[model samples]
Target: MSVFDSLVGQSEVVERLKSAISSAKGGSSSQKMANSWLLVGPAGSGRSNAAVAFAASLLCSESGCGKCRDCQTVLSGTHIDVERFNPTGLSIKAEEVRELIARSAWSPSVGGWRIVIIEDADRLTESAANALLRTIEEPETHTLWLLCAPTLGDVSVTIRSRCRHLQLRTPSTASIEEFLLSNTSIDSKAAAFAARVSQGHIGRARFIATNQEARSRREEVLSLAFSLTDIDSCFKAASKILDIAQNQAESENSERDSQQMKQLQDAYQGTGRSLISGGARAIKDLERGQRSSTTRSVRDNIDSALLDIATFYRDVLVIQSGGEEILNIDLRTEVNEFAKTSSPKRSIERIEALLEARMNLGRNSAPLSTLEALFCALK
Candidate 1:
């Protein structure tokens, strides 16, 4: 399938990117298309998908024909003309930005437009952001810099002001279900269920529809808001969340880490007869790095699910407060019970606590502590 097919309900963003590429190729100097672009949106709102599609368009023969070799390579992330930086670590280090800048200096080996995509521009360190600013300020012809961030507020004004803006919105349930049915073999009922539960997140919907285990986990998490009765219950929920987060992280990453460590420890005879030795300290350091990275990833991943849970409770609070149009009604029964016990004020305070916890994580605080504090505050 074409890359654009994944970005449902983002026609405005698609049109903006298409127009920018068209203007750049049309040689109509009368029209203005900025060198850099900041695609702002909520998580799972097609920001990165739009960026990838735009990069594909920049490298395509007929401006994103979807059938050309350039388009195929870009979509597959093997394009010589296109480079994507999507680090999942704590920060985008200066060295990484320098590498991207160095790569930008060279012409595309494939003799097409060179596009750089910073998938999580919000994760850029201050030094890395400054380093990126140097090239973005005075970009070369045939160069495109596309940055995807959660919000305009997450990015520096210096970078935000320099780029053209593309804003994407979450897709409607109908659109999400239709896309899932068209793209995947998931049954219609399951697709609809996932669409409703995931709250417009295509990625999370796919997860919910694909894995029974994931569905169970989400079910357990959603049921918590209703059963939370006392401070002890809050602590129980927090500890349970922490356990689930850590276990899921281990399940996802431990196998790879083990295999890597095994390979590192294995004896190998090289061409130069050089021995590969990873000492105890080196191995420990590697393990430490992996652990730290995994911890952050796990926290963020868990936070995504928690945000949905919080949304569910927030909707319940809104319903109790006589607010119209409850946003997260997929768990209506559970929410109804939650609204029955907790005053609207209480539920709102809990939601605020969740948001504050998320903010703390964004600021590099420990997730375990932040989560504990949130539950305690909710209590």
Candidate 2:
């Protein structure tokens, strides 16, 4: 098995990357070997993993044989020449890009090539991206830049034109299920359920399968569709959903935030006492970055809830239309009852309302009011 084995259901992409590595190793002067590459895919589609595998292939003498020390270190993110940046804050600043550009000019420390992987290239600020344009357009022969973004449009045209583009699609449910069963102690039934409900997100499927709390939370989110009876119930549901999302986000970030602040304090301990001398501005900047990260986390949680809610409605529509395969197989009975009482047109309207609510949330509308309006429409 090669390091590319983990890229489940992406055989075509695997082959393409392998061919590029072979051509480069053979000194064939193929166009497949490029200084910069852009890997575009949906979230959880394993774009970062693919990029890492490609980097390992470039560094390994045996071309990513999976057991070599070079492949292992690269995959584990300990290789000196393979630098990865995954922004925890809202955006990648220009300073960060400038530093990366400076690093790109250096020769490899221990490997055949120096690889830089940016997992969230879409979060680059305008100035940050501009700072990268020249470096990406004219990088050293032994330096390769791999950028991962959700879509091609997320990157600027100039950068996109300078790089080779590779696209990955969501893995099939069976592929995800098989991967889960092979890797974890999860039973076949639970694995199948998680795969279906995850909607092609392999990481999410594994998470839901392993964590009972996550499964329970998903059940609660799905139950909202069946509980919408009156206006008061809709409002209550909206509040409950929003509160749950916010609380989850806060809980997930609280420990990390505290640890980061502690690290900052430790770093500044022997410097000075006063705010002006001790670098209070740095703490304030950290706080601001944490706030931005928290906001993003909350929005992401709410968006996930919305997707679950939408999936429930989609199941209703599928059942009403006599479709055989519904996404929520576990909710078949409730889906059938709802389908009996609902018309196809009304179900489509509800789905449309959910989609519009998602769009509004993306546009930075007030979350509570937007969700309340959405639940009201469902009622």
- Backbone clashes in model 1, listed as residue pairs: none
lDDT of 1 by residue, 184-262 (tens): 8899988888887778888888888889998888877767656566878887887888787788888888898998777
Pairs that clash in candidate 2: none
RMSD of each: 3.0, 2.6
Candidate 2 at residue 213, lDDT?
84
Question: Where does candidate 1 stray beyond 4 Å?
Answer: 27-29, 255-289, 321-331
Q: For this target, which candidate reaches the highest lDDT against the unseen true structure?
A: 2
Q: What is the lDDT of residue 175 in candidate 1?
A: 90
lDDT of each: 0.79, 0.89
State the lDDT at 85 in candidate 2.
Answer: 87
> Top TM-score: which candidate number?
2
Displacement of residue 58 (Cα, Å) in model 2 is: 2.2
Relative to the true structure, candidate 1 reaches a TM of: 0.88
